[model samples]
Target: MNSVLIIDDDRSVRSLLRSILQKKGFKTRECADGTSGLEETVGYRPDIVLLDLLLPDMHGLEVLDKLQKAPVTRAIPVIVLTGSTDQENRLSALRSGAVDYIEKPFVAEEVTLRVTTQLRIHDLIKSLQTAVQGLEDDLKAAGTIQRALVPSEVPAGIEDEIRWIYLPSSSVGGDIFDIIPLNDHSYLVYVLDVSGHGVNAALISVMVHRFIEDFRSSRPGDREPFSLKEFMRSLDRNFQFERFETYMTATCVIADLQKGEIEVSNAGNPFPLLLERKYTQRLDRDNNGAIGFGMVKGSTSVHKISEETRLFLFTDGIVDVRTCEGTRLGEKTIADLAESTRHMELDDAFSKYQALLGESLPGAQTSFEDDVTFVAIQF
Candidate 1:
């Protein structure tokens, strides 16, 4: 049952309103002055309030302001009751936070209808608030689990050689990467970027991460280097657009620790950059279509790693970011930045790269349009 607080100085007016509202299935409380009305509202926590404009101690507008200001009582709908026909006072009551107004000679039927309407509206707002809170809670939990999918520390045998940065535009995103040791001599390093953003994209990325982890565990630790091309084929065959309704871009690299040889593959993702002391090489000569379409065959090429080589792998979020003038930060610019920072510490290099990216875009941007993921390994 909904409750109503009636704040009227006249006993006769309060009696009439209480009798009329109670018959309409409303629980009612009454106060003869503004001070008592406020006190009762905080204690009773009514669904609505019927406030009379002329009170013994304080004006009705003052009471309305206090009701609206107090957090505990603010949500209760206030309907002003007035004996004046003055347009100014009625306007003042509304401006002071009254949800509605009732004239001095209010009819019983009008009173019931207005109160019922406000109650229904208030209930709907409360329902929406509850639903929004639930969704936020679910996203927070998913973000916690999705973040765990990334490598916390570089794979055991290859520590202090890998540096990375991962930033999701929201609580969860479609970008994921890791450097996993296949054995003491070979490691699997890759960055997978699913199309789109938010929860749907995030869910697909998590599934892909799980699939790769399962495949990793199935292989013998001392086995030959994992096949990047075959793994890409498996991924394409499994995550067809008809099944998951989305596609993804990926750059997978197999690094050989003992031979200093690295095999790199690309699938609709930015080509891996081989940054040398004086030259930068974009590894793949051709760019392939994204996975999940089952259209393009996966391809891989081998590169001889030199002592000063640094392998840079990243999602397109970096090169695709645009300035306010619609200038896209192309791959060439990233190559130049990586080449310039080759001799600096890994953390400093990445920091300078990010700072330059921000400076390129004029204005205050709190986030990117897509998830940004970058990983660099010193060979």
Candidate 2:
């Protein structure tokens, strides 16, 4: 049974309330002053507290404030009992943390109804809080798994030549990228973005990442060589919109160290930016729609890479970031930022770019509206 503590200075009033509450199948406790009432509240942890505004030791509003401030007894519903007809005191009681109020000469039926209603409300709030906490725990677990899909370290021999950054809008996000060493002379680097953000988008991204990892691990020595175009086709065929009801944008860069060339294949993603010694260039000009559409064709092209050549692959999150003025920075602004940072070290350049992006946001906000993935590779 739910419990109530009646804190009133009048002996007859306390007895009357206790008698009525016990008859209504409630557990009851009584105190003659605010001090003893607070002590009883802590000890008993009652479901509800009936507090009289006129107490001998401390003002009833002071007791209510203490109850609301305490972590242990804060959630217990408080109903203020007042003999004074002052509207200000009633409002003050509510503002001070009383959930409801009982006027002087309280009716037994009104007291029971108010107590039961507040108890039901309290129970509902507790249930909702429990459900929300469970969801947060699940999302945290999913975020850990999603983070594992991204590369924590660059492949050997090219660790210092690559730099990247990723930020999700929430605990789990739709962006993922990795650098896998294909053989002694080449590496496969790619960045992918699912259609949306949060858990659903993150689930699809994990599926795609696992699919690519499986393909990399299961390739046979005697089969056709690793082709970017064929890989795109395989991804498109497996994750069609008819099956998943979603789509993804991706850009894959195959860097051949021995051949001094890099093959770029893109599908409905931002064009890869290539930084040379003298000028910056945009690779993969053709716009093939996003993957999972069942009709996405791969557009693969080759570009020469010198020691000074730096190739950048990023999702639209970077370019689509809105400035304080609510205008998207756009591809040209991103290109200009990349060109301006070309003189710095790779890591420093990434830091500078991130700072610039942070400055573009309105006011003190730091996070973007979408998941972001940025990768830079120097041959």
Candidate 3:
């Protein structure tokens, strides 16, 4: 039979509870004060404790605090029995780690039902913890594999200096950006963000990177410069065959500094920002396209690449971050900040923007409900 400890100052209440629990086939122990209850809890090691809020010697909450602190009594499920049904009292009881809260006048059947349910949930939680530990081990292995797939160092032939910042909200992130040098003077700069977070998203990102590498390698003949429109079409076709529900938002900017030309195409991503002469402009005006890699079946709207001195491609995580006042840090803010810091180095501009965000939204917490990635190139 399960043992239960009932603690209350009222004699009548304690008697009623002891009788009811005894009749229900539970071994019952009763105490009249909080101090005695705390001592008895440690010595008796009862399976469950029915604790009251009001007591003569010490407050019931204090008894609960002691039980929580004692490792032996901490796992003994506690159900707070209180006369008050105020929201604050209920929240306090719950926050103090009571398994459940029961009002003083709770029905006998309801109390028994709640206790049984809590025991069952406790068992379930233990099982789930074991399962999760196994899953965590698997995830660690997956993270290793994913990290290995990403290029350790920028390819040697890429003429442009590339600097990247990648942060995964989870063990792995879905955001991926790479600078693949096609030749000595020009390179393929692409930034992609998968729709979701975690292992699935990271796996999809790796697959996308492999596909991009394969596509570039398979192309025959002299490296002819293709328009941004052609690149987007190829991506759409590739996604059509994969048939995966996961969609990828990407911005691919092919920069040829020797020719002083940049071809950019974006599919449902934040517009790439450009800076020059203390001015910032959004390179792609038409943000009206669907994400590629199975988000949509057909070709999406494309924006013709325009010339710019410095180009930046980023994920929505940066712009959609909320300020301390709950306002979104939108594209306008980013553009303005970029323009203001145009004279600074590309790396300096990024650092300044980060500081500006932190300063502007003081006390705002990080992890803005999404992953953020920024890729900048100066030509």
Candidate 4:
């Protein structure tokens, strides 16, 4: 039988929990307060912990914190028990690392269901971890290839400072950003996000990078300006016959600083938010439609890109990130952050925006749901 540790200040509550769990064929260990609960958790190493929020020696949250910090107890699932029955408490408990939170006056069946679900999830995680560990060598090689594809430094003659933040939701993700300079006066800045996660998505990202490089090489002299429409048409034609089932959404912005103008284009990508000294606006697209690549056989309509403006391009991972309360951190929040930090340097502005998002959603883990990548450039 799986072992469980029940921590509550009240003797009656502990006894009731012990009876229920024992009847369900689980070995139960009881602790009278938070202090002893923490010690027992480390010593006994229970598969699950039933912890009460209010305790005599210390608060349940504090006990949770300690348990999470202790290497021996961190992986064990904890379910918080509270009398408050408030949404805030529930959200806080979940964010603090509790697998689930149960309000007082709980049903036996509900508790059993939650406990069983968590245990199953824990087992699944362990299995996945073992499988991944077996592929450690392959993963290392893949990491090397991925890093090589990323530009170590922004291209020369690009006056604007470029900064990027990338977090792959899995071991690998499809979000990619690149800043390639065609010449001293012209540059191509693009951010692309593939529709999925993992190895397949990452492989697609590499293919996109290779295609972009080939497209750049095919273009003629730097003296004559490159046409954004012509480039998109060529790209659409090149991949029109490919057999790949996956499709990619991209936002490509071409800028000619010498002419003080830019041309913005998108293919099913989130609108690139522009942050000016005084205001913020999203670059316009054609009917708000997505531009499809890879297996999709369609021509993407190119829009006029604006110049003398800073461009902020990102994947849905960043824009649609959620808080523990299930509140979305939408495009508006990003726009506000960019506008508020417009006067600051590019790197500083990026850091401030990331920090603000982190503060708004507090948790031990600081990662978005999907692969997140952002690139900002000022002309």
What are the clash counts of all predictions, listed in order? Answer: 0, 0, 0, 6
lDDT of 3 by residue, 210-232 (tens): 88877777753246654456666
Clashing pairs in 3: none
lDDT of each prediction vs. the true structure? 0.86, 0.87, 0.74, 0.76
Ranked by lDDT, the better of candidates 2 and 3 is: 2
Candidate 3 regions with alpha-carbon error over 4 angstroms: 1-64, 70-73, 78-118, 128-159, 167-174, 196-202, 219-231, 257-261, 278-281, 285-288, 291-308, 359-364
Using lDDT as the measure, which candidate wins?
2
Top model by TM-score, which number? 2
List of clashing residue pairs for candidate 4: 262-305, 263-305, 264-305, 267-291, 268-290, 268-291
Model 4, range 1-379, lDDT digits (tens) per residue? 8888999988888888888788899899999998889989988999999999888998888899899888889999999998765677667778989999877776888778888899999999989998888787676577568767877788777877678777777667788878888877778887777778878878878887898888787775575556666666555555442445566677777777666766777666677887655567776545223334433333334333344467888878887778656888788888877888787777788898767657655567655678888788766
Model 4: which ten-residue window has the lowest total lDDT? 295-304
lDDT-based ranking, best first? 2, 1, 4, 3
The alpha-carbon lDDT assigned to residue 358 of candidate 2 equals: 78
- Candidate 3 local Cα displacement, residue 248, angstroms: 3.2
**Candidate 2 local Cα displacement, residue 283, angstroms:** 1.1
